[model samples]
Target: MALIGRILFVALFLGSGFAHITQAEAMGGYAASKGVPQAKLATFASGVLIVIGALMVLLGIWLDLGALLLVIFLLPTAFLMHAFWKETDPQAKQLEMIQFQKDLALAGGALLIFALYSGYGDNLGITITGPLF
Candidate 1:
């Protein structure tokens, strides 16, 4: 069940990670609109981070660190990209709000995964490198 949960959790990031890279130019434009500095580079780098982090978590290799990486990615993204409070347009605000909430939830999930692995990793299931503290 834990293994299945891990897989289901990472499924969200796996495709998104690749999309971030492939759509860096487009994503960069969006990021730029959100005032992200060096948008293209940041987008590409984030893609790399997501890919590596998702893979690590999925494989149970240093799961805590991988989950931390996701948390790192998620928090800033939630604030920067989905600043719904700053949106004047009702529709835009609603959309951003949804995204913001979603990121926050995902971040929470990642944190929970981090805590689980950090505390009781060995008891979970199969892992390539286990949880490297």
Candidate 2:
């Protein structure tokens, strides 16, 4: 059970991180479309943050730090990309708000995981006995 949970956590984080890296250009364009200042910079920063976050998550060394970084990175993304100046159409605005809330939830989850288990240990266990004398 624990192993499965750990694997799920790692997979989730790794996938999210990879998305940022793989879609940096698209992300940048989207940011620019949203009227964000320095869209290119935002895109590059996203890629870097995602890569670092993915590494930490996969390596399980300093995952807390990675998760925290993810939270920081995602907060603005959630707001600027999904929340800010919602669509005029009520339905569209509601949809955007829903997406924004989802992103916020994801960010909060990452933060919680980081805070709870950052450096204590992996969510899994691997033990080996000492050689017999």
> In model 2, which runs have C-alpha deviations exceeding 4 angstroms?
1-3, 10-13, 118-133
User: Per-residue error at 15 for model 1, in Å?
Assistant: 1.0
TM-scores of all candidate predictions against the true structure: 0.97, 0.74
Q: Per-residue lDDT for 23-124 in model 2, tens only?
A: 767777888988888887777777678668656654555666766777887788788888635688888788888879987887877776575564334534
Over 4 Å off in model 1, which ranges? none
Error of 2 at 53 (Å): 1.1
Per-residue lDDT of 27-50 in model 1, one digit per residue for the tens? 999999999999999999999999
Residue 18 Cα positional deviation in candidate 1, in Å, after optimal superposition: 0.4
Candidate with best TM-score = 1
Report how far off residue 97 is in candidate 2 (Å).
1.6
Q: Which candidate's lDDT is highest? A: 1
